[model samples]
Target chain A: MNLGGRHAVSTLNDIIEIPIDAEGDIVRARGTGRDICRTLGFAEINQVKVATAISELARNIHQYAGKGRITLKVLGAPRPGIEIVANDEGPGISDTKLVLSGTYRSRTGMGKGLLGARRLMDYFELVSAPGKGTHVTLRKFVR
Target chain B: MAAIANFEPAATRLARFAALRRALSQAESVDAIAEHTLAFVQTALGVRSAALYASTREDEDFALIASAGDADLPPSLDRTSPFIVELGASKGDLSKTRELGSMWGVDRAIPAWQGDNLVGVLFVTGELELEIVDELQFELERALTVSIVAMLREEELAVLAIQERELVGLLREVQERDALMRADLEKARDFQRQMLGAVPRVAGAEVAVTFEPLELVGGDLYAVAALDGLLRVFVADATGHGVRACLTTMFIKSEYEIVRSSAAAPSSLLAQLNDAIAKKYQSAEMLFSAVCADIDLATGATRLAFAGHPPACVVRAGAAAMIGGGGPLMGLRPRMRFELVELHLDTDDGLYLFTDGFVEARATSGEQFGDDRARDAIEAAHRAHADVGAALKSASEAFVGGAKASDDATVVSVRRVSPEEQAPPSLAPASAR
Candidate 1:
């Protein structure tokens, strides 16, 4: 079911929507991302990069948010690339800048989770508050 | 004139004998032959009562299959009984002991033999046994009695064959189901091994790990990370077993890696891990136990924390002592705080961390390998200058006495090497870059 608010976006033919609810769903969401990347003629290494990025995002929704939805789209106007959006209504991050800035308590953690996913995509956008939940949009172009 | 009278009776007897043979040869089942055979014996033999006994391969005795006219005979006769022996030893139809007839309450019992195997017996009371069968009108009836016994054996084999087929089908079905279950476990094991991280290499400290996974994939995991000047060892035991438990271990590994380098202390890292697991599967099945330790390689100063995990051993030269503060199980609630304790490890001193699987393992005699034994094993290993990891693993295995562990187990020990044992640094600054 579509939540259909500001988070909604028009997509082309290769749009696939999957709900991330459990731990197993993370693997499925990652697999679907890899398949679409391969179909679009992306290099093998870049395809792995995209799939690994999706794993971290899906893991957050499964671990922190408890439930969420992931939307995958093949972007045609964006130079034949892939666009993924992860939306969740669970407790959102209070501060997104510090995590992205990479000055986090980076000793024991893996670059604050979002910082790793952001590096894999050409375009990254994050919107959240303490209570408003989180929505992230990631895009990677063939070029 | 008397010879002509005898020829007339002999001709009549031959016609009667032919009729009896025709009737008995048509008996399809043993039950079908019972009434007809009894009627023939009672009337043609001039006997008051008659009974039939049949023996099958499964039976050790001839059982009274059918009886008519209430002949007083035993319900069954053992194969070795004197009554059956004497009857089997008879020439053809009647028991050899004609004078012993009243003892069996039967004048005669005609034995049916197929190649020396006693197949059946037909017993009759009244005047028939006392008369000589060759002189009597029913003399030719002996041949018909053998046909009834032959039919009984054939019917028994047919019943047994059908039962054997059904048993074979049931055995095959069970074997197929077992094969499927084994395949599932193997796949899960491969997945677990793939996601597991390697043990950490702490400088100046000798690190040894002991791990015991169950027959099926289990949730025990050891994740090590070398961060800055400390080696962070995260040992965890997730709840439950099987594929789901294996998946949870992977999830725990990923979460720990993400927060490990950023975490300020052992307690903070545990709190973050607890938050991640608790926030997910809110169900009780998601609970787990863990010990997080950050060892300072230079000073051998260790910061330790436990979340429902057993205490780690601080084994010095004299003896072993356990050190860890109280904490609740992870995944029960979010944002729960984990307490930490600080301990200093001198050179040659061993710091041992283990899951409950080590201390709670039971012997065949139902005795648990409690904390005291674990202390002794770790202490003895260090005092003997032995490999502490192998010592702990073998000690627990010997305690369980070759029984498969009921739960998964993991042990990690990092001891600061004494100055005499430490190797040279073996590295230069790469010609000053």
Candidate 2:
């Protein structure tokens, strides 16, 4: 997607390159998601849910990753959907199940946030290793 | 099998049933509902104790809203306690049980619901081998649900009331701020208007003044003061616009008026005004550029004092000359001295005093309509017309065409009149010319 002169591509074939430290990156990501969902003829409730999910994931990457990038593209698969891939080079997840179970301990008590995010989006995947890095991919279908 | 028949009074059971129904329906608040329902359950089902616990969505914390029967049980149980009951639990769910140490009792936890949404739980306990009254349990749950909904409704109302009060407070603050700003603006506009002196008609000179402020208040000022056989004309432009700039100009005007009365020389007036402004407005960092000229009406000679102000043009015999030497802006130094230059006026000569606003206006491309352009326009207007007012107005409009003015533009033109023009027509003989 091309957003305000900045390009963001989901895959190597359809890649969008945006400045790593661009201003209002979070707002731009969410706005682009909303605009794409609307243009793709998605329902209002589904659009809102997808936008909120993208915002939360993007914020997490920006805050924890120190510096990272995001890519978005329209996935032409079994269903018409939008896929968002956020990756960062930082201290990766130690336990994947605990993070997904919403039981991981933190200052905010790990309160059901991951579970809520899972519930909000249709397909959610998180791949992280302690030493390597973290990658999150989320997809929301129009149907 | 041998049959045994026993007779019991129908009135007793009827009276008990009527009392239970009355208690269930009369429950109003959450506590009242819980208390009445617990009492009914204890009486009808012969239970030892009953309690009601509510779960809040914000933190999933449970609080004991009502209790009945034995005081032996702990005053409260945490919302997370399995014995206290939770959503998706039934009476026969053994997996959700707590070890009760050889105490045989019928303990049932009923989930409280409001329109298919589970909101809380109700717990009832009875002695060992006690048969629970199914009809009584059903009635208790229904009554408790109604009461809890009422209490939640009241809570919602209270929250709405608080929000309404907060909104009203914010609205009042905005209104007060708006009113204060309006009054300040009115005051600023009044001060700007007072700073501008009325158009003066010299007995022997032709004069015209034009002042256009970009906003409700501006920083441009022009004053004409005639005292002690001297005609003092001044034009000042302060930095910026609106209330603060207008205030700076007002202070300058007041200080100049005060100094003009005591000082006969233009340089003395500038020095005194500069000292007063520098002392009074030092903290605000405000400064002004001004051109003050003292014209001797008797001798038709004017002494000019410039304080970083734009040069004034003197036009005589189809030639124009820039009058006065420039000095530092006022308010920079406490004891700054200014030099005065004198120019002799010829008949029909015009002195045009102005501010940078006339020359520094920007075109659409952000290019400045520089001083040279302004001078050309002035000369063109003069050649096209002889009226000084018309000429200046034409030149300003042509130079600032279709562009937003950046500051206030002011123009004051003074034309010297010949001696014969000043003399009364009846006293001058027709052959005198």
Candidate 3:
């Protein structure tokens, strides 16, 4: 499993809309994430990777981003995986490269959550503009 | 001088009587006895034919046993013979000309007696000899008495032997079937036990689970996995109880294994599961309710999804709150999507997941233990810092108070742990984490 976040492709087989509301709402998103991974035939270890990555991604939305919508869709053809996209209009990260590189840490919380999520997936991407908010796209393959 | 001259004839008559007695004693059954009696009567009386009538039981009417000259005797002596009337009035013996004899001329009706009881009657009916003296008739009656008694005894023993054989055969068949059923149940129970194994190791959470089935095989199932730093737990309960329910659990377990790889995406996983089950068991009434949750230990972020299952409870600082999402029950429909709820867990916070069997468990008075009771148990466990599994068990057991549980009960407690409580960073395996 690769945790690198990347940009989303236009291919889709199935799509799901999950709203991240209260702190507890992240649980449902992660559950749906695991269900998709399991259906894709990910091993037990890979399933955990997918679920943990989803939890971290969704948690980022709920915590730093206030509340956001997590859009899950299936990718087919070139690669088969469940693509997880968490976008928020919360205060955007000022240093996207530094945060992704794991060198930057926010005073309020450990900076490892996003980095940890990146390490858990096959592909990861982060798009953010200061004041505009942050959008993250993650993909993990069944193979 | 005249007495001595008749002595030779008397000895010859005595010899004949001995031969008749020997033949009657050696007869094996009623039919054999009948044949022997007819032959002896015919030879000694110098008659062309003789018939014997017998009663197998005292309450039954007499029927013809054997005939030498004719097979025309009526099935029952009472129907055509006045001999029964004459014999009934006199138990000793009777010889009379027939008032109304059928074709055979009536000669004598002599009672076949064993002690004072009459077992049968011998009828001598033919045209030839009217010359039988009183002494000759007395001898004939005594021989008839011995033969008739032997015949009845043999018939009774034969019937009893046949009845006993049939009864033993029936009992053996029942016992064999019972043994086969017992073996089959034991094998199924063993297979179910093997399907449930060790709990998954999650990074930042401590998971404790308790499962109790009402029967050797039950419908309760649970799965725990810590993959890529995320903790996922699932618990499900199929409908009904006992062996049928137990079999249904296997389907749930296998389907979950395939879909659990979806990891954090429980909605699609459940939808796929529903499709699989609906297709496989189209005609069956079997279905399951489930709750699936994924937790990110690092951030204490958790997402929960349910399919016709009870909501999970999150307990923090001794306070319990309900969290649930709704959807159609799994296996009921294809391509169904479930609602998802997201939650964050703080240190020392725990999520309590269970099947309805836990809340719906009944007390001796038939009162259900309900959701409130379950919350109370979790809260008590949180306050006491006790094992949640034990606390839930104790509370339900107390309420039940010796009443048997009507359904299988399962509980899964996933508690977020402090940094110190977690495994050392290096010791935390990198692959699964």
True contacts kept of each: 0.00, 0.00, 0.00
DockQ of model 2 vs. true complex: 0.01
Residues B239-258 of candidate 2: C-alpha lDDT, one tens digit per residue: 88767788778777878778
**If ranked by DockQ, best first, what sequence of candidates would result?**
2, 1, 3
Q: Which ten contiguous residues of candidate 2 chain B have the minimum total lDDT?
A: B1-10
**True interface contacts retained by model 1:** 0.00
Would candidate 2 be rated incorrect, acceptable, medium or high by CAPRI criteria? Answer: incorrect
In the range B318-343, model 3's lDDT, one tens digit per residue, is: 69987784568888867788877888
TM-score of 1: 0.50
| Per-residue lDDT over B71-134 for candidate 1, one digit per residue giving the tens place of the 0 to 100 score | 6777888888887777666655443635345557777666655566666666667654223344
Estimate the TM-score of every prediction. 0.50, 0.48, 0.50
What would the TM-score be for candidate 3 when compared with the true structure?
Answer: 0.50
What is the per-residue lDDT of model 3 for residues A14-117, given as tens digits with 9 covering 90 to 100?
67777888777677777777777777778998887787777777777888888998888877778788888988999988876445533344675433556666
In angstroms, give how far residue B195 of model 1 lies from its true place: 2.2
Clashes of each: 16, 3, 53
**What is the lDDT for B60 in model 2?**
38
Checking candidate 2 for backbone clashes, the offending pairs are A8-A16, A9-A15, A9-A16
